[model samples]
Target: MDRSLILGLLIFLTLLAMPFALPLIGQGYLTGLIIKAMLLAIAAISLDLLIGHGGLVSLGHAAFVALGAYAAAIALQSGIENILVLLLITLALTGFVALITGSLALRTTGVYFLMITLAFGQMAYFTLTSLAAYGGDDGLTLWSLATLFGSNVVQKGNGLYFIVLGTLLASWWFVNRMSQSRFGRVLRAARDNPERTEVMGYSVTRYRLVAYVIAAMIAGVSGLLVMQHAEFVSPALAAWQRSGDLIVVVVLGGLATRNGAILGAFFLVIVEELLGSFIHEWRLIYGPLLVFMVLFAKGGLSDLLTSKRRGNQVA
Candidate 1:
């Protein structure tokens, strides 16, 4: 019944009830918004694995999402309809690319690593744009949603919603476990003190490369969901601006906390929606809000919420 577990439980219940609750509130259009947030949260959480735990700041993380989406579109284009098969292909493709890029990127640290990731990302974006057969610069559209076990379950009512919710929960749990494992310890130690960790016999480069691959695979899964949800795969998914937003989501949520990504995703998407609705020039306000958060809320909203709970408990 501690704060962390309580927070986790609250998130779980809220998501579980969203589909039903949103409809009753006559704001069911928000369901799509929630799904978008959840999917983005998955990507953001994966990025957090690198940023928070591995201390790697990748500016091109969105490339993996675009890769996943393209993988799905390409697979379907090639006559593949099985959701499982598409996901496997997508994850494998993402893993392969991540391994190759990570091997090279991990050779450098700090700003060099960040820049290399960005380069790889842009390479992916341009490559997608050049794919004329699949819509290229205009992007490709799925004829329909991928079938699960030969059924249109994903295209049916609330089926995709529930599936996405399940995936998000599983991802949150998996990342949480990963952050608490011995491997997690090695990653954190390497992050805090690479030389000492290297002297202790752990291969820092290999650890980071593995983390990068895992994060990429997770982002790929989110891409799968995105393609299903949007029925469109565009090079825009791999744009540097998207990657920057993912980073913003991670930092905005409170780096290092298991639920921070989720909280940040909800906050970012909701705020954007509010601003877009109320102001013609939303970025003017949104940009400053991010700067304020970075300057004043070092731990992000997750930390802000937990602090209040701690104060209440102490009293």
Candidate 2:
């Protein structure tokens, strides 16, 4: 078997067995932590599509997460308890917002694009904070969460965990496929040389805008899942800090690598949990790790798992 396939199978098996195996070792509580990591992975994967393939640095990505959460929460508050409906609403809103914001943000490149994204993210945060009816700055605690055919399976137990895992896998696969597609090639062309791509008859901004909307929709799905898991929605979900973390995850994993975001997200969560368990100054340690990775690990942490063990091994 190919080494990559072997590694993938190993990862999939481990994740599938985690819920059952952890309980036998009295580490069942880690399930929630793993779920958190997976959710973050989902969001990070979406951001990766922007930063890696599209060469778009969006500081406002987490705003879609917040929007998705708030949209679901508010819908539940207004008596919409169906998960499907909530997901659709979340996608539509996030996609529409991304279209508008991306169209405007794509007007610039490099630092300007980054700054505009930050501005849009802050605008989303303030907007969420001002929603007095939905708990304002305090956030809204969900009394009722979305359900699949009125079943509570998705609300707790092993169901939500598996669903999230599936979503993570789907996101990884989707992004990988998209990255190899012709559209992704055009995006890459634009990213490498916009003027050249434009001269070749491609609309750089349009391609970027599409990528932005797709990323937002995926992030929104992550947001909805987050709200479901937390049973709460807050403006904090869309905070600029959260957006920064997503970027860190993408970079920490590996840019333009298929599994980079997943690897990065899991590594980050584990490190934080491990360090925070021992030291109160966990974030202080976080900075050094990034520096170390940047200094020593050229392809980011993903390469650690992905690269062949032997130098002569052909992948």
Candidate 3:
């Protein structure tokens, strides 16, 4: 096997063993953190598809996440608690919204596109806050957790952990496949040179719109998972600040690297959790830390690790 395959397998195995090993290491807290990180990683991976592969930077990505979470919460309240059904509803809602917004947003380029997406995301957040039936700004509590085969699988920490892990694995596989597909090639080509792509008879706008919709759908899935794990859905899920955090994750992990997103998610979550445990104002510290990472370690934590590995090999 190639080095990349071997490295991928090793990472997979390590993650697979984490649930079994964490408790023994007295690190059960890390389990929840890891699960949250993995879900965020899934969302980041979706964003990377647009930002990294398609050169489309969206500031409204969290809107899809909010849509998914609210859909799941509403579905559970309406006596439709099946995870699969919730996911489908979430995907449909997010994709439809993406389709509408993307058509308009893609009309502009660069900074204008960013601002438009940001505006839409804030609009979604405000709309959710006005949803009195679902608790408005306070958000709604999910009275029941998601079920599989009539069993509350999500109630068990390990079970929910595995569910998130499975979803992350599947998402990573799908993105890897997508990056190598003909559509992916076209998207990359367009990113490199949109005018050339347009000259070759591919509508750059159409390709970007499709990618945007797909990314929203994937982020919607992350939102569903988040709601299931937290047993709550709120307007905060779609906050513009939340979108910024998603962007930070993408950039921290390194654009276009799938594993980079996963690593970035874990690193950010763990740092927050660990630091927040001791300091209530941990973000005060984290803010500068992130700035340092961006300024000094532009390639991200994954790149740092790879560089260290190469150094050791040389030594």
Q: Write the per-residue lDDT of candidate 1 for residues 106-214, one digit (tens) a residue.
A: 9999888999999999999999999999998999987867998889988645899998998899889989899889988999889888999999999999999999999
In terms of TM-score, how similar is model 3 to the real structure?
0.93
Clash pairs, candidate 2, are none
Preferred candidate (lDDT higher): 2 or 3? 2
- lDDT string for model 3 (182-259, tens) is 889898888888899999999989988999999999999999999988888899999988889988888787677647
lDDT for each residue of candidate 2 in 11-50, tens digit (9 for 90 to 100): 7789999999999999999999999999999999999888
| Candidate 2 wrongly placed segments (more than 4 Å) | 1-5, 308-315
Could you tell which candidate, 1 or 2, scores higher by TM-score?
1
Worst 10 residues of 3 by lDDT: 306-315
RMSD of each: 3.6, 3.4, 4.0
lDDT score, residue 149, model 2?
A: 80
Q: Which stretches of candidate 1 lie over 4 Å from their true place?
A: 308-315
Q: Considering lDDT, where higher is better, how would the candidates rank from best to worst?
A: 1, 2, 3
CA-lDDT, candidates in order: 0.90, 0.87, 0.84
lDDT of 3 at 257: 62
Instruction: Indicate the worst ten consecutive residues by lDDT in candidate 1.
Output: 306-315
